[model samples]
Target: MKTSTRLEQAIKKLYVAFHNNTLHPECCKQCAVGNILNNTDSWKHLSDYHGALELNYIGKVNESFGRKFNGYSPSELLKIEATFLKACGYQLPLHYKNSKPKHPTNKDVLFNGLTKVVTFLCELDGVSNVMDYTKLFEFINEKPRFQLDDVITF
Candidate 1:
């Protein structure tokens, strides 16, 4: 398949996972695109439009964060982390305790922080609807390497 088609299929898979309430960490992975065909629950059916929207939104958000701040301050990082969590259809936690600092490099620390944020986002609920893919793409394209394909399927 073409890359565009592959991306579309990936997006569709995400939507299906979302609608079935299977997009959580237990059912899917942090990489939403990879989760599409990762053989999680099972490739039961094509994702509906609603599922696609949710998937696309999450993808856009992830791409946005990756582009905007390759490195970020701790506090700014926390907000970005929160945005990622929300994009994954998760609600922000009532209280967020800071993790201990161990990594020496900014990249290492950012990776560790993102891992925790992704984990927290995966635990959220009540995400069972489609969003506007156009808006998602627009927001994501504000940063580089974050463009949605013109067409999608599967």
Candidate 2:
């Protein structure tokens, strides 16, 4: 399937990070968005607090000017990080007081975070989520129940 250049690049980076054991939920420089941005922690400046869904003043100004970091706007970056963190069992605005998984670096935990981030990225790109497997089961009797194009809407 055709995908935007930026989307493809982001997915590639995530793919490498997931397999290379570089994805760490608590580290801004090693999380999903961080890996997408080439393992940089700069994206954290987009939000006042880590794991926050809202952007800070600087992030708002950048979004106003259509500024994008690695093909993702400041707001989009914030959302991506929040989604990853939440899926990895981290409480919002992550901190010592927030609830988190007993094993943040566990492969299963990281995989869950990666799945959600990829889904969110696909949503932003207006494409089918690459990780979605339900479509494989959405057929019957050696025939398709729906057209492939219909799946893209999801």
- Tens digits of lDDT, candidate 2, 15-104: 899899998988988998889899999888888899998888988889999999999999889889999999999999989998999999
lDDT for 2 in candidate 1 is 33
Model 2: lDDT of residue 42: 86
Find the 10 residues in a row with the least total lDDT in model 1. 42-51
Estimated TM-score for each candidate: 0.27, 0.88
lDDT, candidate 1, 1-154, per-residue tens: 1323333444455456445544433122422322444543221111212122222343445445663222222223334334433443443331224222332123433334334443332322222112324433444335634335432212
RMSD of each: 17.7, 3.1
lDDT of 1 at 82: 44
Candidate 2 regions off by >4 Å?
138-140, 143-154
Tell how far residue 53 is off in model 1, in angstroms.
Answer: 23
Backbone clashes (count) for model 1: 2
